[model samples]
Target: MTQAATSDTNVLDLSTCDSEPIRTPGSIQPHGFALSLAEDLTVLQASENLAQHIGSAAAGAVGLPLARVIGDTAAALVVTELAATRVLERPLYLGTVCISETCYFDVLAHRYDGVLMLEFESVERRASADFRNLYPLVGEFLLKLNNTVSTDAMSALAADEIRAVTGYGRVMVYHFDHDGHGHVIAESLADGYHSYLGQRFPASDIPRQARELYTLNRIRLIHDANYTPARLVPAINPVTGAPNDLSFAALRSVSPIHLQYMRNMKTLASMSVSLIVKGKLWGLISCHNETPSPVAFERRTACEQLGQILALSIESREDASELQFRLDLRRIMVSMLGGLTQGADFIDNMTSVFPALLTFARASGVAIVVDDRLLTYGDTPSDEQIRELVGWLSIRAHGDVFHTDQLAAGYPGGADITRNASGILALPISRIHKHYLIWFRPEVIHTIDWAGNPHAKEGAGPLDQLTPRTSFSSWRETITGTSIPWHKGELELALEFRTALLGIALERAEQMAELAEELGRANKELEAFSYSVSHDLRAPLRHIVGFSDLLLESASNEDLEKRHRFLKNIKESARLAGKLVDDLLSFSQMGRAALRPSTISMNDLVHGCIEKLAGDTHGRDLRWEVEDLPEVRADASFIQLAVYNLLSNAVKFTSQKESAIIRIRAERHPHENVFHIEDNGAGFNMDYVHKLFGVFQRLHRMEDFQGTGIGLANVRRIVERHGGKAWASSVAGQGATFSFSIPKELPV
Candidate 1:
């Protein structure tokens, strides 16, 4: 055959091997012959070796009913069996049929690409084996498989069991890892047979098309690698005008390169059974022989059954293991939530669960970042590196989590921290705050034992065809700059953790929002206070000017009593104006003051404020009702000022009463302390209550209640500074109650 004999018409090289069209090689192994027939049993194409296998008439059978070549009885069996099968791309046995007086063959039929492929293998070659005798072998394998526990153990058991059934020189269980690289996990070898037990094979060893074929055809056998391929009479199918899809044909010839690969390995025959788990080709059970060996179809069927059973076992074990791993992650997530709800800041709570966090995703390190604050645990990169990573994460991770096992491939800066952080799983705790919780995995440096140096390739073959590697010795490859790839389960757990972290972060963010609002309110009040101060101060200055001008006018006509009265009035007004100026300065200072909280007895604090006001209340008929007050955590000086303002206002407002009554008490709730001051005074109307807490906002006439309105504003500011609140409730003529609340736990 010339190079033009292959449909691809390209020399097999590293660049074109993947597209080699191994499925449509247009030939069959010389041990068995294949025929491409139309739907009505017309022979569209026949193998060239039909004359060697059957007779000269069979060799020229194309464009004729298959009954004309193989006798009517044999062709009828193929037609009847295919008529009963519904699913396509799977071979159905037609049993043994005699094409002539001496030509007896076992036939298999399958449909693909609108054509029926019928493959024939000589039954005389089998000494005695058939399907009826293979059941006990299957039953015995099942009984021992129940004793196996781990995946490795089961793989070893399968390799041993398959070798015993097939009598292969070497049988290996090759498992594919997450990276699509295969490694020999278990092996059974005969005497003088080489072992590939611990070696790895790159994914390129089997090109993409070959793996696809394995998925469609679960078992493939090459009886003799050195046999010349018997070419089909018509290279392309007449119906499709393309190469017939021989994907399901048992006798389909494999790629010449693969045949060369086997020759280089010093093997004459090979068979492979695919291990498909959950509808995906997971690995293979590879068998090789040192001589031209052929197993009966019955034994091959038994091996196929074993492969199915092995696939199921592997799926069950992997599912069970993943389930347990997810359950473990759930427990760690529960512990993390417990810590987060302890009323500390997000960083502190996350740090408290650092050990569990590391174990949560099998991470080597973890980092919690909120705003500009960063906290790290276990093995970690430098602070600068983490911050840089956070900056990058902030752009992509809006509300979802992001993860990558090959961090350096996606993030250039990651190359510098391969030792500490080759993999990263980052969850955005709060996008608003630029907050994140990240887990890190360090680079795992290990060596791979390849069957040969994968990169080593020799010059082209005699006809410019790429040759297979000559050596099959173990070659060690030391890999670097990559961590163990994160599995689907781990990525799922990270998303779950993200959901939980968002909840805690949202709660903390709400508190921050409240603080922001308070600051905004303070700013507005400051602006209003500035406007009201100038207006109120101008009135006092106007009164001083009016009295001094009147005194000056009366100076020329000075009666002694008028002169004395003017002087007294002038001096009293000057003192009142000075007092208002001092109060305004104090109010300004209170707004800017920082809170220094300590434990204080509300009872003692209230008593101190009342005693300070005793001089003004000494001559009045005043009654003081003091209820027991609770101890609170607050700044002593600030609380005292607030309490003084409330008590002093109570005293002045009720001075009109013949019998003045004042009450002070406190109440404690689960989260805050509420204090109230009630007075039986000439209370103001509730219509204008909103103005009660504004700076210099007076609800009553100045002549009726002679006091600055700055007191309540000052009280509100002091209370808010400690993350508390203050308010008042009143009736038109009865009395008023002033109240304030302070949180049990302060904000940081």
Candidate 2:
């Protein structure tokens, strides 16, 4: 009953076996018969051996109504049972029905793609396990399953339980790794059975299409691998106009290549129940037998249920394990960060916390890059190699965290460091500072025992070129240059640590920036102080020397009036020099003095400043305008000096005016209070405003304005020390206004 060779497979290459259409094989196992029917119960196609199961009357069943082939009673029962089952793709069992006087078959029906598929299995083939036997087996398995502690324990329990129920020679719980290769994790074998408990299988062993089919059809069985496959009567269904999609069919004939695979393993019958966890095919509960063994549908159903429970147990345990790992990482991070905060040097802090840092992500070695310096712990690459790897990572990275199990594959420069750093997990703490935290894992060399040499193949045939490997002996392979992969919890915890470390790095960077700015300002102030000392202080001293010399010469000539005038001139020059020194001392003290803020009336402060400068305005006809000023909290003495400087400048500059007009006012704001003093004076050009507040900076000539240029600079320093600023605006020769602001809530 084998399918005749077709032109489609004439050039089939052994390499392209994965593309073989296994689901549309247009055949069924000899143990059962299948029917493809239309919506109206018309038989579109039937198995060629239908007569063996039913009678000669139903042999040519194609193009006939289901009632004409299997009789009205059986067809009516199928329609009635299917009517009660609302879902599609899952077959519903319709209790055993007698087709002939001695022929009793268990019927199953399901619908897919507008076609209803009916399958019949003869009850005489296998003695059906009654509920009395099925219940105790399932209940015991569930009870023990709940008691199992780990995935391996659960898998072992499942293999034993499934073998107990199905009477298979051996059962193995196969588990797939992240790379798709499978290995047996647990096994239950009968006496004298050869074990494959530790053997691995390549991903190609079960081709991609076959794995996809396993997901859709959770349970599949080959009653007898050596039995002939019963081809469909018409080969193609009239409704689909092609081979029927038997993905969800119970008795669908599998690929010939797979049948050959089973024979190579010396297994005449096999069954597989997919372990579908979280909607993905995680693994399989594979069973094999040396002799022909057909499992009843009821026993197969129990195995499927057992597989589901096993998948759930594995998922739950994996979740619990991940949670525990994350909690452990968190504990390690807390201790490590605590150590970090104890030291100011980043490298020193990391060095002290190195042990917990390694334990944080289960890394074998660690590298901390700070301020362009590389520090290593335990097994790691050389400093030069690490720097090169970091450089490459900086260019290839798309995010703050990057990880790979095969660093040599990911980074070309890492090839030389495979023994020490085959894998790396890099987290950039601060890209601006070139700060990075990298963890390394050394190469893990191990040998793998594959079920067979996956590379070996037999010579190709013309029609069916693909051949399953004949040998099932153990084939050893040595793996190198790769480390155990980083788990999801490990990567996730690394990201969390990166976020926290970035915060600390950014804060440190900001503090450094502020320190640099302060240093620059201090340097500028030192330069200005030097200039004032060399020029401003020297001028007054020279004047006193010249005046004293003149007085001494006039005394010898008996010119008492000239001598007295010279003495007065020398005395005045000395007083001016002393005043300049006093101003400089006050300016210097402003920065060192701590703020002593108290509530004060701005009105009284302004009036006091005006009164102090009354000496300069005594001879002039002056007019004053005062406004009600807001109250502020500030250092009273400093505010007074600042006000006095502004008022004195306003009066001295307006000395030539016939009527000097001065105005004082204050502006209130939510955050601070601003005050202004306006005067009709000989105002300087606006272009030179930037020099108004600088030490020894002046706009007018020395003879025209009789004072040192330290007055405005002192004003700026005093106000600034009180968390305020002083500035002025003026139009040339028209008037000038000086303003300062004091924050209501001054900085401590």
Candidate 3:
């Protein structure tokens, strides 16, 4: 083969190279003949070697119907298949067609660029016999594959099987990584042959265009790397006036640069089958022969099937492993939730679960942020570095989870932090506050063994051909500032953990809200109680002093009835002052008391309160209507006190009525039970309802009610403390109803 020369001005520039034009090269390998036809099956162009296989010369076949050039049977078969579909990546084999009395050719038809392209190769009568014997071997190979456990084992078994089936000098399983670079993971070689296992190749060696073709065709064969490419007679299709697309052609001529690459490696023949896993190209099964060894279509089809089976097996094993990993992580999360429930602080709970997070994510370190506080565990960057990382992420991360293995490449300041933590998986627990839970992977300093020095050549190759590297020796290079990449399972686990962390944040917010509400109520109650105590004590003291002075002035000379009246007035005032003090102390005690809840009948509690209020109802005409109430979980003593206060107020306020009616009933709710006390009493105005529950907040004068105004206040305090609410509805001159609801269950 003559090498094409390149002028100095037109030397190949790697930076400006485009691989798209390679798809339609308008040429075929000389090993077979190709013919392109119009829509009416008229032969437009034929390969130069068409005369060798058929009775017609390439120039003479032009403008002739394809049926006359090949045969009526072959052309009819091609038309039948093409009529059903025009786009076919896989060719339709039309069997043997007799072009002449002594010559029979195997035909393949495919549609490309609106043109029907047919390829012909000479076939012997005994060709089917060789393929028939290969089926039993294929079945046995598949059975052996079923027993392989891991991906590596499967790769090794597949390589050995392909080598045995093809009789190739070497067979290698080349696996591509996330970055598109490939490494020889498994290999089967002849004795004394060089091994390519554990050797890496750069992504540019295959290029994006070649990878795309591999995905589409699935298998490619090069019978003779040194053979001259056979040109089409017209070079371009007559209908479209464009180069024919040979992307799916079995005998499509390869790029000259690739041929030079194979020649430099001393490879005479080569074949490759793409390994597609879950619709993506995973890798390739590459076979190289030292002599010109052409693989029959039947054998290559078998290789493609084997690759498909291997891909399915790899996907199954990977899915199973990931499932088990997720199950284990979920178990760990359950334990972490338990720990969080027992801990007093959110940050402390996260710190306690840090080890579990690291294990779940397979990370080296972890950082948790609750509000403005931050906590880190294991091998992590300095506090300052972590703060910077958090700040950087706060601005860029848009979702609940963000992860990257090459953090330094994305954020320049991360390079400083990469010494201890290169990869970061961040989960924002609170987006508003920028609170996050971050997992980190330590920088991994490792060496890569390349098949050849990737940096050996510069942009000095010929324009028509890319220079191939001369060496195949292993070249070692050190790499840094990158961690082991995060897998899909790790990202999923991070998102799951973020969900749990968010739950914790929500729970904390709820607790804070309840606490703030309780504190506000307590402050208001304290102020009311203070004012009530001061006024009640001072009024009684003034009464006692005034009556005692009157008694002292009357002495022995004054009338006995007047002295008796003064003494009696002083005694009554002192008693009233003492009772006021007792009531104040009781209300204060209710506020300070702890809750000890248990299952109790609301009916029994209400009945007990009625019995205690019987003394107050003795002089009054009372009618009681109490309904059956359900059982509840609450502090029994506190509930008793609350019921007593309500009953006492109902009885005292109704004393002025000729016939007072008290109705006590309970209504069931989804999460709580509500009890109501309806009383025909001296109902206060609705406008003063807000003040009805405050200590010393009285609508009626003391002379009319004849009691200190602490009963309703105590009732509100006790009910609220029990995780329930108290409210009242009333209108002046009408009956009033007081209702309170308690939860069905109490928290421990």
Candidate 4:
């Protein structure tokens, strides 16, 4: 046998296919009855051969009077023989039946007044071990076949495998249009055979009656189309009064006309496996054989297995498509969430990241819907258009995906209006009530090589429609699943993200408003504090100066001792009180001043302080030990004040000493700048060092070391304002080191 054989040669058999376990014909006689499903599962066609074998009188006479023809006596024997499996019904059954020439027929009995052929083929009495192991294996296989990435690929692959398995010359994947017509979407043909890859067939060929019967059972085989029996119709129908139609129950047959049509196409013995979906016939597996041959019971059984695999694969593919869709949406949502920044700039940049989303919700053009009315369209519609659309959508907007194949008569329920709207996708898009997003597609007279003509589809009267939708009467019904649908979750999520941006913007604006208010309050308080210092505290200091001066003036030169003592005490007390007031002012000012930091040389500042003090003091030998003070970034005036105060205090405290030692030095450390003013003079106890930098907190009495006590506190405030620290280490009567820090770095 050639690896690849032509359709004109000997018939190529797949009975020994290496890809699958081989199955042969059954032990029972090959001769059997025929049942072709059709006409709402009720119409059963029984052949004359079948009628006679079942002990019926005639062909057409048996169908209309089935209970009478397949009599209770024969029926009882048949039912009793195959009673373990199925339940006889008004036209529905669950299991198979066996009918051989020897045993009295029990399983298949027909009751009809309809348009299809219904029969129960023989049930396998002795189940094989190979068949027993198939349940779980096939279940798992079906489960996996449904999970393939591309449903189209799975469909094609299944068609190829099924053709090989069933010995069919050509196996095709057929997709049924809404009008019940079918198109061959994919096909696997024998070498040299012309393929029907994209052929279209009308619903009239299959008829409404033929498609309805596919659901009762799935596999159909017309082994010999030219010779099979025609169904027996007792009176043709209820109107035809007399013995009429043929009985085809026993013999497998096809119509002469259909046979001629097949012969014209150069094919024979066509068999199809129904592809049922969501309780409707979506399509079928159509197979054709060029040669006259019988697809025996064993081959039919094998084909059944392959058909099951195809069903499982299609279902799995559909499920995967849905799952992938959800995952993609979830990922997009997460990305949109992450794009939220402090401002809309983050979101703006993210638009390019997902350029396709805005169009996910595209329109032929968009129209805004308000109050169940059209407000504006792709570029804002006129008042007339809005009113018209609103009226149309108002009638259908209670959570339904609406479409209009023909709007030549305008919207439904409102007469006297005419317009051609080839398609409409109106989704109520609004966070609030009475607003919507409507999309419109006008009849563009585009070419559609479909039912009516293989040319442009032009707009016409109300009856004109497209493929799968023959006329306006069945337009909506046929296009039930065709639309750019709005998912509830997706719409809600988009709204939520848009709202979240506005929320962030609002929060930032609120923060700015609050900061302005606080700034205004701070300005008013500083003004009040400055006023109090200038007015209330200054008056008392002025009085002290005047009275002390008068005391000095009134005393004569001879009373020098008493006058000197009184004036000294007055000046000292007044000076201290004045200093106290000044310190208070400085403390208050520190809080208001913004820190202006800069690099300053401490050695220069120290020298300057010493020069000013030296101008006031007479010559007294004092060695100044000033180290190489490094530069520090700090407020210049503040650092000067701190150094001056420390140096001045040291000068005063050492006035009584014979030789004063005052030192200004800086030590470099890894993290901070440290400056120390060490003086050998009066120093306080280590325990009193804690009070060194506090306001008006002095460890030494005025009689020993004089100070306003605010100097160290001022130094602490200044250093801290520059984000540094100030502290003093002192020992009683030995020495004191007043150390402060200037931080090394700046804040953001």
Candidate 5:
């Protein structure tokens, strides 16, 4: 009674072909269907069929009664089996099950009246004598090794081991997409073949039918395209009892174009070891044979065993990817933190520190939240634009990189911004961190040429573009990897990163508020300090001057010589201290003073300086040649101070000369016309010249030059405040020249 029974398909019947059509405890048969039974063989003689196939004598125990033969508990399962073959007239799939006490074959049953015949199919008992049969050992090795190091290098290392273990023409680690578009990403080919390193293919060639079955089933073996099918009873689906074998190669009537394509790709027999990540398909480890060849039973078994571990290894790689992303993030944040302290540009600093970030994030351009007028370098956004975008980002509360799609969701009101842009990444810049590192990625548009007419070839094995995707359509969906929804865990992890960033933004806001408060307090303290110093020092200055006069007038004649000398020294010291305090007060006041611009004649100013000096001290022989001078807009008092300081310095330093030769001239450089007070003086080291204009930075000793060092500093302060710079050029024991410029007003 071993017959392929196809009585009525396309019709579902709940009516029992056997007794009662009993439900299998948890099963509801309304959704369940029945199968027709195999007929015309002696019920007992059928015992040989089960015995010869299952290698168990108890299979012969048929027709002894349903309970004695298979037991009543298995009744519904057997009913499922009968419905399968009877309705479909082809093979069926049954869940894992047991038959006689000693033997098991996943049972697929069909019955007629009191008569019942059941078929058992092997789940996977293709074990062979080889090292690969011990999967447990390899699994442990992979698990232990994964913790200490990366598997990519280890996988390459395993090439020799894998080749020695499984003899195939070429063993490649083929990566696959969620849609089953696969490519041979890594391979160990013998030689003499085109490399498939960066090649891609269509998912439809594998077909939805094939990809779905790959996870539920593993260890596919095609001895040859021409290999004859082994004789066996067929089965139907357990749920629907439809023709069951869903294997890709099992399509006996598959297109001839597909067969040729497999051959064209130089595959005689192939065994693909699947690398599944999560429940979604990730990639594969496919082994190919160029010639018509068969994988030995052991090698096939080993490949399958190897696949199980590789699948799990691929799954755990998610955590590895996350960890690396975090490490890179930490490194970037640390670099940004360092820039804040060192006064470096945040974006540029991060670029040098995280060089691979561009490639990792697929960024075409990176920008920071910056003001163009304030930041003179890099592709800084204009102040007007920056202020607007910053306000928008703050209002919308942007935190992470967003695909163009995300803007529609993040800011529904920001639809116009989204339309103008392809993608935007918003990184926060906090006032507490002055470097304010924020990263922006502008979408780089790629003008991809569609295979314009995709599917120029069909009937190609695993090479046809099937399903909704076509070469003619835009491939934006595939590039994003966003078409298939993210797993719950992965989406949650992405959300966690956003949560961390939100925390940072809130902390930044608080820091900014605190900074504002601190700035106000500092201003008050500075005003109080300035006022106290001014008031407290003036009384002592007046008393010192008054006492010095009294001492000079009242000293006794006998002690007049010594008393006069001491009194003179005290008077000089007191006057100098008083002058020092006045200079300090002036420096403080200059910080808050507004500019008073005037058209000052440079020649008039130099002449005025010479006349003042001439009146102050008896004339020394000097060569004072004033060149034609340009009228410059400047503060009149500050310009006088500049000329006075320069004249005073030249006069004092050149005092030692029997005939001092001082030259006053003006010359032009890139931006401004500089006037100089040049003199052959006792100059200092050229290297320390930069420190010359700073307060208390006089080159001459106090006894050598009877003047305070504040004069040159005051000159520099005034020059800078006039929107120009003051500098001196000199060599030790040689002459010196003091030059200053008043910058021209710039256009707004």
Candidate 6:
């Protein structure tokens, strides 16, 4: 079934309605004889000229067993092979059969619509086993094809080979474009013959149905363009009372319109072999002769095999080229990713990275719109024009990627931009913000030479038959407002690049959030520390000052024991103030430290931390349980510091317990690894968990825990810096489990 006719102006005006029905023509070329049989092998019909060879009246042959019409021996042979004839429209050669004592004919059989049709043609005298000589020639032809690296080279070589082998007056390799229109890419002609090379033919010249038949039947041969079509006896089959479908018949008659087309070209004989690639019609190996030149069956078979070999070579070469192209693009993309990491901000460094991106899509210019910042590189449109184009794309673009060669056709006021960037391949990184990465292609003006005037009309025939263009003169057309169209590979690369760019944008956003949080916390900590220093330090200083002043005044009068007590109180207050300052300095250093990430074993890091904190755990009845932990990519010093803080807190808070229990293990999540340290210690209230990881925020009294409330805060900062998070869960009296998660796979 065919689709409904489209009203697109560019569509070919092929006379679809008036075209002859070539498939079910109910006729055969006079060069061969045809006969039809019923399910029981009874002759139901025969060609009008059957009696000339078989000495039997065509009418009298009907209703007779095929054995009586031909011969018992020949009929038995045909029946034996009929059972294996499964493919419709594919004829099976049944060898030669003697029609009479003086004549022998080559027999071909095919089955259609439950009826068997057989064709017989006179066997021409030829050199015995002539096909055997074509094997080496075909081998050489294939070798030549294999050595050719490009499609055009292969096409040229094929045309030359076919012309040499078939001895035809002209042979051309006609290639079909994305549209059904064809052009002779390569041609070889005999002396005094005009060339059709580089000439474009409209799609209507071949019609849709004709192209379909080409795929079904790989080779079509018209021995003589002007030969009369032989009428089948009864015209329509007796059993079905309809025209015979001569689609697969070797001697099928040509359509009248097509014959007229051949006459218009002034060609006497023609042959076409389908050049199929990847199971679709790629083009045709068209052979035309200035005179009636019938190619022998053996030579035609060789030509068919050659076309098949060429198709395989074409597919292989194209695949290899595409693979190499993708590899090159991937290499360029990798370089672009490396460049993305050169600067701290992705958007700020867009101009520096723009050149690599433009090279990726082979575009003349590029425009990157990340949020409000728009950056242009190379020969780009004006700032106003770019903004306008981006605004248009914001509303009209579909999916994550949008591309067009004729940009002006889609966007109003885009023609000005098209002067430099006629084509645009745009990828939106953020839909909400309308962040985009666009590559631009400049206009490429060229001329197309049609075989005949496309707009001219010669005359109309009966039934409003669409007449073929009468003139063979070249008609040139200059095209504008377009750029070289983007290739499929380029589009695929753009999509891949889009994914990478989006990832970078997301990482940048995350880094910005982390910075903002760090800055905000620093400001709050500065304010809190200012107040704490004034209040907490003043109280300690007051005690030291009051004790020292009292001791100094009464040094001469006070007893030795009272003086010693005063001095001791002063020393204790000074030590407390000094310790607070040291803790504050350590907390500040944790925020300023640079991260050096490497693959380190958590088990080893935890053990090292425990060894360092041995003094705190000495002489205590502590039961330490450490499970096997996986290795992770992180800064060794930072992770160690976090572990040390958690472990020390567990030992300090559990000092009152007769026996303390601590456990360390790691749990795996889909995207991250979570490590936990649990202790059966003085757990804090769940209500105060929100303040647990804050700077200088303590859940327990300072006298009870002996901490500056900086341990958990440092752990949180370290985890956050490594693209992870930290939290704790506990009951009031049970144990607290402190856990931090790190991403399993780090991004590039």
lDDT of each: 0.84, 0.83, 0.81, 0.56, 0.52, 0.81
Q: Could you tell me how far off, in angstroms, the CA of residue 525 lies in candidate 5 after the best superposition?
A: 13
Over the stretch 1-748, how does candidate 1's per-residue lDDT look in tens digits?
1243355455445447778878788889877677888777889889988988887544479888888888888888767766676736787677778876787788877778788888888777423336775688778877888998888888889899889889999999999877678999999999999999989887878888888889889999999999989888888888889987788888888887888889889999999999999999899999999998887677788889998998999999999999998898888888888988896577777778999989888999999888889899999999999999988888755557788877988887989999989988888776476778889999999899998888775555454335567677899999888887787888887888788777777777888898889788777777766765676666677777887898899888849788778778777777777777888888888967788899999888988988999998999999999999999898899899999999999998998899999998888899999999999997878888888998778888888988767889889989988888998899867889999999999878
Full candidate order by TM-score, most accurate first: 3, 6, 2, 1, 4, 5
Task: Report how far residue 666 has shifted in candidate 1, in Å.
Answer: 34
Task: Give the alpha carbon lDDT tens digit for every residue of 1-748 in model 5.
Answer: 0112244522212122122111111111111112223343223312223444434343334334443444454545555554555523222344444544444444434332222334444334322134434566576647655663554544443443455556766766666654456654556666774445435555644545456556644555554654332221223323344443323212122222333445656676666666666775666666667766544434555566666666666557767777776666555544444443342233344445333333333333344444442231233344454455556666555344323324434544433433233344444444332222222243233332222223464335342332122222223222321112223333343345345444555655677788887577446535544553454344446657676776766665576766667677677667776776776667555556777887888888888888899954486666666778887888788778778888988888888777777888877666677787788877778888867876555577767986655678778778878778888898766789888887777222
Give lDDT tens digits, candidate 6, residues 1-748: 1113355423224446335576877677766678888889888888877777677877888889998988887777677767766635577676666656656666777777457888887666522225686789778988788677788888888888888778898898888987788988888889987788998887777877788888888888887889777677777777677888777788788776666567777888889999999888999999988887776666777888888888888899889999999999899988888888789878776667777877888899988876668888988898778887888889988897999999889889777777778999999888787688888899988888887866674565432235555666788989898998888998888888889888887888899999998789888888768876887667679999999999989879749899999989999899988877887877787768887889999888888888887888899999889999988998888888888988888888889888999999998778889998999888989998999998778888776776666678888988887889999999988879999998877544
Q: Identify the runs in model 5 with alpha carbons over 4 angstroms from their true place.
A: 1-167, 177-181, 190-195, 207-209, 224-268, 278-280, 290-297, 309-325, 338-366, 370-400, 404-424, 428-455, 458-748
TM-score of each: 0.68, 0.76, 0.85, 0.42, 0.39, 0.84
lDDT of 3 by residue, 314-393 (tens): 88988899899888888887888778877657887777777887888888898876666878898888877888888888
Number of the predicted model whose lDDT against the real structure is largest: 1
TM-score of 3: 0.85
lDDT score, residue 726, model 3?
99
List clash counts for every candidate, in order.
Answer: 0, 0, 0, 33, 17, 0
Comparing 2 and 4 on lDDT, the stronger one: 2
Best by TM-score: 3
TM-score: the better of candidates 5 and 6: 6
Candidate 4: segments with Cα more than 4 A from true spot: 1-55, 58-77, 86-153, 164-166, 175-185, 191-193, 198-268, 276-282, 290-302, 344-748
Q: Report how far residue 526 has shifted in candidate 3, in Å.
A: 2.0
